[model samples]
Target: MGERRDTQLDALRAVAVSLVLYAHFLAPGGTSFLGHLGVRLFFVLSGFLITRLLLEARDAAAFEAGPALRSFYVRRAIRIFPPYFAVLGLVWFTDLEQSRSSLTWHALYLSNFWYALRNDWTPWVLCHLWSLSIEEQFYVAWPVIMLLAPRKRIEAITIGAIAFSLAYRFYWPITAVPALARDLLPPASMDALACGGLLAVRRARGADVPRWMRRGWPAFAAAFLAVVWS
Candidate 1:
């Protein structure tokens, strides 16, 4: 039910990947902020694409939630787990100290929690996995949210998620919590995903791009830069 691919999205993915490469390889000191921007872009793209697939699956299954949910989970595991485990297997075979030290957390997709609680990126080779952990968290949680919410209320639910994420990010800096926790935790980082989901919902309903969004991207860009650079 989700076989179609968008060339536009492919182009966007290429751009996102290039940005991450630039950040990691070219940016002086490997500016982590730029890498973060790339990861956030990937998150938004994933939310849009995955939500669209789930919507299509639901419709194709005649809203039979069980079959759609099971199919999605199966496809996701087959697609995601093999390559992931292959990497871990290589790490284990080579006896990489950092990976060996934290293999359990990485295998369980809980590396984000490990890094945040430790408040240090000791295993730099595995540092990138925190984002993957966030993505896995999104995959596990988003389908249930999409299927259980009333169709008409889905948009509202997504917006509420975005609001909660933004609020958490704003409030977190004042707390005694580690900065890594605020940035790595799912709750504080959901705004980009929710915004992507909102866009998918609107497009599925055949709604035109809102006038505000069409005109406000510059403003949005400015605001995002301010927050990231602050």
Candidate 2:
């Protein structure tokens, strides 16, 4: 079971990271489509793992709530922040003599909004790290979701996902508010992550294998290929 979980999780992440890298390094025709799908898959995967971890915490006797929140952020920081700051340090060393601005805001995760506001902010090397900020913000708040809410309330998580995913679409002007554009990762981008959380909840209860999903994987695959061919 754990092996299957790891495989699917890796598959989902590998799909996103591969597409994002391709979109950056190569001029692939399907990059945009694949990138969108891949990013969504990442978010879904995140939700699934986060939900699983929270359930484990909920179930285990020694699992305190503090670790639930702390370890989540710690693991996230270890995975992301080190290389991220290294890039910033590297960039700062190389090009301050030629470039127009300082590295302050980018370090602060405010670069996205800064550039969006100034209209002068061109792309930089560590540009993709902006998504990391969004993910971190999600981590910071997601644990509380598990903390306050009852385990049986599955729709609560799903509704939260729906609300978040739909928020920017409904409130674009507010979303378009650009001061912290980098900080504000679009809710839609997180839809897949939330889907993963839902799946996690399913997994804990043996509901992980949705009837429709189990029944339809083959059909879905065929239809997906048909759509691709057409």
The TM-score values for the models, in the order shown, are 0.94, 0.73
TM-score of structure candidate 2 = 0.73
- Alpha-carbon lDDT, every model: 0.84, 0.63
Model 1 per-residue lDDT tens digits across residues 127-147: 878989998999999999887
Instruction: Give, for candidate 1, the lowest lDDT window spanning 10 residues.
Output: 221-230
Instruction: Pull out the clashing pairs in model 2.
Output: 43-192, 43-193, 44-192, 44-193, 47-197, 48-196, 48-197, 113-181, 113-182, 202-208
Off by over 4 Å in 1: none
Tens digits of lDDT, candidate 2, 1-230: 01125776677678789876776678566445555455556676777787777777777767667766677677767877898888778777786444326467677765545455664435555455556655666777777787557777865766578567655444554545554342245463455567677777767887556688899999966753332222
Error of 1 at 140 (Å): 0.7
